[model samples]
Target: MLAVLQVILLVLDIVWWLVIVSAILSWLFAFNVVNARNPVVDSIGNFLYRATEPLYRPIRRVLPDLGGIDLSPLVVLLLIFFIQQVIVLYLIPAVYRAGV
Candidate 1:
């Protein structure tokens, strides 16, 4: 059980980090802070989009737009938090403290 919680926490941590990185990269890409001509950088951007888009799409549809600035990621983050902190933690109370 301890190991399972650790693994879930580790996964959640990874997903959370990916969300941050994806957000930054997305901003940089959107605002042209980073050069997109580099194949590797472009690929990274593409990969991030692929990974994050599914989570964002439904939220995007439901949430009102912020003057064209999407707030779906915020919604998605909230959902993720609920899943990790509420759902997972509640489901595995014994493991939650150990994981944290």
Candidate 2:
């Protein structure tokens, strides 16, 4: 059970990084800092979009339009942090201390 919790935590950490990368990549593409037409760039952008958009889509719906700014990734990162804190600070200790 503890091992499973640790694996979940690791995945969350990875996804948090993914969200950050996706947001930054979008900004780069928008600002023309990177060539959107490049095969490498397009492939990476597509991968990130596919991975993160499912999670971001619902958050985007709940959030109001902010013109060009997107806050969904930040919100998702915060939620991930909160979940990590809950598992590490509460769930893991409780389970271990309880001899489970």
Candidate 3:
């Protein structure tokens, strides 16, 4: 139904932001801009890792090694954007036509 698709869209949006935040946090950690030793920072990093790792793992497996670069987050964000577009441009319209 439309409601279900909307929920899916909402979840995707949340995930999209999480991925962005995780990526930014990673860069901060890499550049030593954030203190990893601090309990608060460590906890936030761990939470983000746990939240996004499952989504990134599969993509990481398929992607080629790029030395120090990690592209999984970018790939995940693209896939999420693609899914959101499909849901918005096609699926929702179809649902409307079907009177659901």
Candidate 4:
């Protein structure tokens, strides 16, 4: 059970990084800093979009348009952080107590 919790924590950490990278890549694409015409760049962008878009779609619907700015990523990051904290501070301790 502890091992399973650890695996979940690790996966959450990895996804946190993915969110950051995806946001940066989106910004670069938006600002024309990266050329999406290149196959490599396009592929990476598509991958990030596919990974993140589903999560963002619901948040986007809830949030009113801010003229082109997107806040879903920030909201998602906050949610991920909150979940991580809950698992670390509450769930893991509960599991440890249960084992004893």
User: Which one is best on lDDT?
Assistant: 3
**Each candidate: how many clashes?**
0, 0, 0, 0
Best by TM-score: 3
Q: Return the lDDT, model 2, position 94.
A: 90
TM-score, structure 2 vs. true: 0.96
Runs with alpha carbons beyond 4 Å of true place in candidate 3 = none
lDDT for predicted candidate 1 compared with the true structure: 0.78
Estimate candidate 3's alpha-carbon lDDT, on a 0 to 1 scale: 0.98
lDDT of 4 by residue, 1-100 (tens): 9898899989888888888999999999889999999999999989988988988999999999999888999999999899899999999999999993
Clashes of 4: 0
* Model 3: per-residue Cα lDDT over 1-100, one tens digit each: 9999999999999999999999999999999999999999999999999999999999999999999999999999999999999999999999999997
Q: Each candidate's TM vs. the true structure?
A: 0.78, 0.96, 0.98, 0.94
Residues 1-100, candidate 1: write the lDDT tens digits.
Answer: 7567668778877777778889999888889999989899999988888988888888878887679687776777776787788646575775566664
TM-score: the better of candidates 3 and 4? 3
lDDT of 2 by residue, 4-38 (tens): 89999999999999999999999898899999999
Ranking by TM-score: 3, 2, 4, 1
| Ranking of candidates on lDDT, top first | 3, 2, 4, 1
RMSD of 4: 1.1
